[model samples]
Target: MLKSMTGFGSATQEANGLTVTAEVKTLNSKFLDIYCRLPRVYSDKEVELRNLLTQRLERGKVELSLNVTRLTDIRPGVTVNRPLVEAYVNDLRNTSQSLLLDVSDSDLFKLALQQPNAFNSEVSTASETAASDWEHIQLTALEAIRKCDEFRQQEGHGLESKFREYIQIIADRLTLIEVQDVKRIPAVRERVRNLVTELMGSDEFDQNRFEQELIYYIEKFDISEEKVRLKNHLSYFLEVLAAEEANGKKLNFIAQEIGREINTIGSKANDASIQRLVVQMKDELEKIKEQTLNVI
Candidate 1:
């Protein structure tokens, strides 16, 4: 089975008065590249989360975001620094007195709270609660990855079908080339004979020499080997596509080989009809190459 590198997945779970949502989106890339957005409290887990993504996804430009929201009425743990607030208020009162301006108590208190570290966030004391929350986040992330894989699998099916179609079209063109090739050789021989006779201005061309020259010329244009190699490459491509493991890079390499054979055949075809078929093969191969980028 083949897999596509493009996919999207997301999961959400609520536990311990916290709602965690994980989202993962991926696009085709030659290597694994991960970008993560984690809440500040969970920032320390970024490396672990990255490793998890690497283990699951072999290759892609991956974007992962984790959103932690407090669902309950209770806010995150925070406590006011009473001493800091009192000092700030004293400073504000002195400044107001010097400026001969009146300051409301509520306004002073609000301004004091806006200063840095005016409040401290209390770390959770319950180890089990923290552990459970982390576990929930991990599970949510794994579920998102699982869904992404499923998306890739579904897209892979479509890609497989497209590949089969393109390969078949190229195969059909190769068949047409073979049909035209049969007529090409004899026609080329006759044309060469006529041209030689015309140049000599008589039917005095040496039979032995002419035969030798014709044999060499025909050998140069012989695409039999190229045709066979191309067929084999095409067949091998289909075989790899049907394999159990994902092999996008291998398939790309095979596509290059297939292109090489097609180009060789085109350069040596010599026949207009065969050249046209070669052009069609090139077009189909280009499509295959484009689609192969999304394969895994």
Candidate 2:
């Protein structure tokens, strides 16, 4: 039931000659982030719209946009602030006369206020609903968002399966190391015996001192503790992955722990087989770590 933090949704509604629509898309993020683009008149609805999005989403960088059209008996129209335009024209003419400038007939003032935003009128229609009956539009938008979440779930399931596969590979490699390390301790003991015998040749090296030094040297090279801790970390990582939420950061931390233990084991293990297993485990772990960066 895990979900990724990336998705897309869009919905449209038409009510009594009023059409409104909403679209949302998201990307993975450590926290819940929202950006909205709404029409100027409906700017007041921003808080309510954000609340609706937060209800369904827990974490991600989300972008939302709203589009509205009026489809009533009324027709789209434009209005111009004639008084402002005339005032600018009169002021410019007076300035030109006072300065004695030989300028041509000017079209600057007329051209300045011609755009939709400069003196544009608000949308109005036979529909009484705000921004073309947005109630149904809100519902449609929510449904689209739900579908988006479903897709995220499907994708997250695939990632979960891949995680299990790589972790299993690492576990199998660890098992190989465990089996081959049995002879390593015996080999170290024999080498210690040989070195002591050579050093004491007719010189009478102390047996007690030699035994103590041998114990210290073998224990220092032992990777039993590292192996046990590494196994425990690997188990914890799998458990975290199964949780029903966005655990990307938590999973990354667990992977770090696993890597630390693996490196420690690699450095301490003196046997060729153990070293080979360590390399294999590291390769698998690195792959898992790379894939985890894309997880939500």
Supply candidate 2's per-residue lDDT for 284: 86
- Model 1 lDDT tens row, 1-296: 89999999999988778888999999999899999999999999999999999999889999999998877665456789899989998999889989999889899899999998899767774555677889999999999999998999999999999999999999999999999989998987787778667646756767787777778777778999999999999999999999998578999999999999999998888888888899999999999899889886
Report the C-alpha lDDT of model 2 over 1-41, residue by residue, as the tens digit: 55667778777777767677778888877778999899887
Can you give the TM-score per candidate against the true fold? 0.78, 0.72
Query: Which residue ranges in model 1 land beyond 4 Å of their true spot?
Result: 73-124, 194-212
Worst 10 residues of 2 by lDDT: 123-132
Judged by whole-model lDDT over C-alpha atoms, candidate 2 comes out at: 0.77
Clashes of 2: 0
